[model samples]
Target chain A: MKVVGLYEYLPIEAQESFLDVIVDTPKASGHDLLVRIQAISVNPVDTKLRASKVTVEETPRILGWDAVGIVTEIGDAVELFQVGDAVYYAGDVTRPGSYAEFQLVDEHLVGAKPINLSIEEAAAMPLTLITAWEALFDRIRINPDADAGKKLLIINGSGGVGSIATQLAVWAGLEVITTASRDETITWSKQQGATHVINHRKPLLPQLKALDLEGVEYILCLHNTDAYWDAMQEIILPQGHICSVVELQNPVSMSLIKDKSVTVSYEFMFTRSKYNTDDKVRQHDILTKATQLFEKGFLKTTLNHVLTPINAATIKEAHRMLESGKSIGKLVVKGFEENDEQAN
Target chain B: MKVVGLYEYLPIEAQESFLDVIVDTPKASGHDLLVRIQAISVNPVDTKLRASKVTVEETPRILGWDAVGIVTEIGDAVELFQVGDAVYYAGDVTRPGSYAEFQLVDEHLVGAKPINLSIEEAAAMPLTLITAWEALFDRIRINPDADAGKKLLIINGSGGVGSIATQLAVWAGLEVITTASRDETITWSKQQGATHVINHRKPLLPQLKALDLEGVEYILCLHNTDAYWDAMQEIILPQGHICSVVELQNPVSMSLIKDKSVTVSYEFMFTRSKYNTDDKVRQHDILTKATQLFEKGFLKTTLNHVLTPINAATIKEAHRMLESGKSIGKLVVKGFEENDEQAN
Candidate 1:
């Protein structure tokens, strides 16, 4: 199998940062499905993992999480999927990822791909969609009927997860208030169904007050949590909820939220797969529901850029673009290079 | 009206720490209900407020929250209770508290006292009951049927809030695991229907493992949050919920729970009343439900100590006991001294 992987961590500008290599194809076992990669997307998690690497790998380390693929084989224990099934998933972060022509994923984490969308389009939705879905529905558990017309503030609403989260919150009947600094980002946020767009570069409370919103019932923060902690505390309604995907780099004074009786949760998409929790199969269910929404034209693919002929060079370029922190929506790499098979 | 209050912050040993003084009786307005106090309980909040006071008040500052009283008057807008109704409540912190002979409370924050319990017994319940109920049912929102048999760890199971929380969790069909160090506390926790009692003074993980548990799905931390932060992170199951009433005095690394995707909430009982939230009336509903539980014999009064003839001297003694940190269950004070009226 042809794979884009790394033996040592290096900057994207270095020629050895990513390598085109050959590895023996792995077989499906237990509840695993052997998927032939069709397309994969680059996310902040990819760059973070790469940059945080401190140990040299004995073997090439694969590092792609979001993928749209065809299941070529399925283990006997797999009941959710079969061979030839087109599936999409944010693969497990603890195991070998989807930076290869073939990869293995647990059937519990794979969902039937939306038949209406292109492979690159479906690939772009998994990681960010799963993150947004779990952060809003699973963690915050916002109810559509009871919480309809309630305000939800999505921080960094132009980013990958924020774009999907804003749409989902709007779809769930919430009043979506999102933050963006630049004109392009603000337009992008509004295009995703945000009812109001405020500049993140400015004081959030003043912006919210200018819009006549005293506080938000829910806040989904996709940017720097440490930077937004105080603002979130100030603007969250008493007994409100805040879910953040970003990890805080420094110790925060959590007591600031005590007087308001606030709830703060972290939404790490990998928790289920990493812990092998009893509800791990819920990921598949969420993706399946997302697929239905996509097919019904309620959701649009977030893919903004795509590169063909998936190879070390293309994957490195995707990583570079993501690391620049200016990329909008999602970036995907599709199709394995024909010459890469000869290397295998 | 006779009230036991303070004009200045002083040590419990000081004669002026608490003073029995007379103030003009207040009239009810808006949602307010004027109640004549029958019994009042001293909680940690009373002691903390006394210690933290810096400004000498021109008007005496009353320091009591939990009360069982008779509704002597009702404002025009008050519909929850009428004159002569026996009610119990954790009065608003922003208002003059229950220390006075007559106190005005929002009718929405008051509840019909349990007919099955005595005034002293009911007085011991309000503050801790509201805190526990809000933490479990409102903040964590643990479903009785869905979460039946799931483990809940209460960090200080024999304290006021923990005692009630343990009973409530048990009544909801959850397996209640609690922490207590003293033999008396352990016995008291067991009486509250805790399935297991561990020592908070010792390491928690080993004790839980010995009890054949790897982690708990829920934790109600009733003690120092900064002290237990790391242990709570280590013992909480992935996607678990933790609610704490204690405010952190020092900054703690909250990112430690990110990998497990945990939800951490602060459950301040004063939140609704302090913020005047839309759901402020939920406190009335919670106390009403608790009243039904007490009537049905599903719950018991946690009051274990009582002081007679409510006065400045008695309040000072109660504060001294609570500040000692070894007082078990709840300490309540009942009745006004015969000579105190002359002083007033």
Candidate 2:
């Protein structure tokens, strides 16, 4: 299999930071599906894991999260997938990722790719869509069956997760207020289903109050958990729920939310898969719904920028773009092209 | 009205601590009730509030959270109380407290005293019962409506709040595992409704494993929030919930809960009454339910000790007893002398 991986942690400026190498492809076993990668997307987790490596690895660590692929082989234990089925998934953190020609993923983590989109477009939908789906539907309990007038604020609504979150919230019929600092990002967020845009650079309270809202019913924080602690504490209504994907560096004063009778929850999409929980298949269910929604025109792909045929320099450039904190949406690179593209 | 308060923050050894004085009896306004206190209970909040002084108060601060009393006056907006109703309540923190002979409380915060219990027993309940109820039914969502057949860990199950929390968890049909260090407390916890008792002095993980359990579904922490953070993080099942009544002085890591998709909520019973939220009267509803539960033998008072004739020295003794961290169950001091008690 043609794969990209790292043997040592180095700055993105280093020449051999991400290498395109070859590893033997393993047979699909149990519920695994051997998929031939068509497109791949990079997320913040990839950049973070890359920068945190302290020791040289015995084997190169393959790093990628999002992918649109075609299943070429299925394990005998698999009932959900078959050879030649098109699929998309955000591969698991503890295993080899999708930066490869052929990768095996659990059937339970794979979703059918949308019929109306190209591979890059479908690739952009999985990771962010999965996170947004879980955060709103699973964690915050927004009812897709009912058309209630619920309001949701998505902090950092122009980022990859936020772009998908804003769309999902709107699809669920919520009044979506999103935060963005730049004018271009704000306009882009509105195009992605945000009803209103507020500046994340300023205090959120006055902006929320100016919008004729005493407090929002739900807040899905996509960035800066510790920074928004005080504002979230002040702006969430009594009994209102808040879910965040960001981790706080310090222990927060949860006491601030005590008087509001509010609920604060963490939304990590990997939980069920990580724990092998009784409800692990729910991820498969969510992804199926997301695929349908995308085809139904309720969701649009968030692939803002796409790089050419996959390689070392391109992978390093993708990481650098994410680290710059200015990427509007997801950045993806697809396929094996120029021969040197595969080498470190 | 006669009142006991601290003009200055003093060590318990000071003779003038919790001094007796005369003050104007406040009139009821809005949802307020002028209650003639019959009995009052000492909780950890009392000692914490007493040991600490208000920089802005020139006179004195009175601290008492729990009370059994007679409603002697009702506010113009009051619909829940009458001039002679017997009541029990855990009052708001930002107000002068029930240490005074006639204290004004919001009617919504008061519940009818249980017909099955005496004044001392009723007095011992309000603070702890409310804390327990909010933690279990509201925050942790144990669902008395469903079979939460899963086990719950109530850390510090012999404390005032824990005594009630254990009972509530049992009432919700959960398998109750509680931690109590002393022999009498362990016995008392079992009597209250604990299925099993573990020693907090021992390592919690080993104790849980010895009980033939892998992990608990919920944990209610009633003491030492900072000290138990790591233990709770380890033993909580993925997607489980945790609630605590105490707030930590320093920040603790919230990231631990993220990977598990777990929820950690703060339960401060004073929240509704303190903020006078739209659902504030729900406290009245809970107290009503609590009274019937107590009378019907579904719940029982946790009063373990009582002091006769509430006075400065007896109250100080109660404070000292709480500070020693040895008191099991609830301790209360009756208002005035038996003959003088009627004088209020």
Top candidate by TM-score: 1
- Candidate 1 on B29-104: residue-level lDDT in tens? 9899999888899888888888845788999999899998889899999988989899999989998888888899
lDDT of 1 at B321: 88
- Per-candidate DockQ values are 0.75, 0.52
Model 2: per-residue lDDT, tens digit, A36-97?
88889999888878885679988878999888888988998999988988899996877888
Model 1 CA deviation exceeding 4 Å by range? A339-344, B339-344
Candidate 2's C-alpha runs over 4 A off are A52-54, A142-151, A212-217, A234-241, A251-255, A258-263, A336-344, B54-60, B144-147, B251-255, B338-344
Q: In model 1, which residue pairs have backbone atoms overlapping below 3 Å?
A: none
Scanning candidate 1 chain A in windows of ten residues, the lowest lDDT window is A335-344
